[model samples]
Target: MLFRMRFIPLFFILLSVAAPQVVAHPHSFIDMKMSLSAKQNKYSSINYEWKMDPMTSADIAYELKGLKPDDPRWKQQEAIIMANVLMQDYFTDFYYQGKKVSFKRIPDSYHLEKDGFSLIFFFTASFIQPLPIANSHVEIQTYDPSFYVSMTYPNIQQITLPSEIAANCNVSLQEANITDSMRAYAFSLDKNDTVDEDLALGKQFAQRVDIQCP
Candidate 1:
């Protein structure tokens, strides 16, 4: 049964002290890896990278839709998102776990493509994170700096905290769990950081999420 839309921690995204602001997205989990290649006019093939085995792929297939509250696919998304939040909170409570975060590394890159105004997050793990990619629909508070919205290829946009979100980035998936389902992430502007470090965190988070799906 569809319960009351309890977006308690879903709508507002409270960044760390470095990014002292909260925002929302019309689409959940906008940031994800995917691979895609068109074969003439046929349906272009797409897949998620985290699908290391067979079981996860079967489960993630439906939850990534981020459909309506009562839509048949809503429950699936909810379960996956819920599981992600639990995992994140668990690891985030203290500090770093074993391998930095908790995601597993895979050999394949996720196959993805553009769809209308969303950046579709497809993976071999059996599920896809339906993202609106054409136009930017994200918002950043004034206190936050360094923020960028990408309308191009994957790993294209890099938004910094304290940086105002463009008028284009004004979307937060009203249908999906913003905190758990969002592809967007937060980080500091320290030069000491590396892309792979962030990638590791993202991978761990994604891995945690992939395991949550029923």
Candidate 2:
């Protein structure tokens, strides 16, 4: 069975005929890379790059095969995907001094490409107003609230900071510490199952990027 979601389509490649009860915690996976840039010590924008897993990429490619770039259907699909991302706030939550920060998506910055068997998505978001970084505490987390998709940064090296504030700002990646019980609960859910909205299961599994400038 195949299931489609906001960002990546979920492909059940490992479905078993004999033991059909087994389920996967996350239907799809995304490897994410991010970079933050500043303009004169003020936070300017964040650039995002996401690489979909091979199986999911293959499924997506097959689904959209034979459609040329100029095809109206192809363009429509891209628009739908972007609209979904916008509804989810681009899967990013940025906070400064405990207050949520506002950003505007750069429409032209959104694009997709293929890298080997993987599909890559690129986008940029600029702050509504360039935020001053001095003596500030910023927390950034990227995640899918539903927990249907798993997003991760393979390493801290995948996150970049601008040279202007690299010296004054200290950055760290804090991985999620999900308990054993939560893990079991997540595994118990089937692809068709939906958790309560307030649960926000994905947030519990998200890695936080903390930036402190002094």
Candidate 3:
């Protein structure tokens, strides 16, 4: 029941000068990976799983025009628009050995510090579609715990964004806004029990996380 917060403005659109509009939300990640184990001589790693919605070009147009889907501007930008829409699915629930591990996100304003696994959300120029990483985001690590943390398995594989799922494949363009959302979470298999064991470990992970989006 605990998750981390995120508000690191991964991308910047400057929707409008007078209004200073921005279209990026805090929950936008399309690519993901899982963790596996290798100590057993098998090629496997363990990582929490998460899914997101496919970004729609229509959404980007609306954000840029500062209007709803039916707005006239949407029609104008419809044909000449590029987008990097993302949606969420699930999160890592538990680890194998009951070590109790988890992750979360929080929201905040534009602020990014240089870190090892910083994913810079950049905005790309597509003829009709928008790439999600064109601007300047500060985070993107394929590893479950990212470069900041070491992997626990011997077959730890480095995950990354697949090309086929990219936005600038069929279209001809360069650059894009690279932004991401905040995810706050923790670990503990207390939920799988028969409702008799007290899940205190999960709460411990929550206690370790503090709001850093503000």
What's the number of clashes in each of the models?
57, 0, 69
For model 1 the TM-score comes to 0.21
Task: Identify the superior model by lDDT, candidate 1 or candidate 2.
Answer: 2
Best by lDDT: 2
Candidate 1, poorest ten consecutive residues by summed lDDT: 142-151
Residue range 2-120, candidate 1, lDDT tens digits: 11134322222222222223232111223433332223321122333211112212233333345555664555454443443333331121111112222222212333222433323
Alpha carbon lDDT at 193, candidate 3:
23
TM-score of 2: 0.84
* Candidate numbers sorted by lDDT from highest down: 2, 1, 3
The TM-score, computed over Cα atoms with residue i paired to residue i, of candidate 3 is: 0.18
Query: How high is each candidate's TM-score?
Result: 0.21, 0.84, 0.18
Task: List pairs with backbone clashes in candidate 2.
Answer: none
- Residue 95's lDDT within candidate 3 is 26
* Highest-scoring model, TM-score: 2
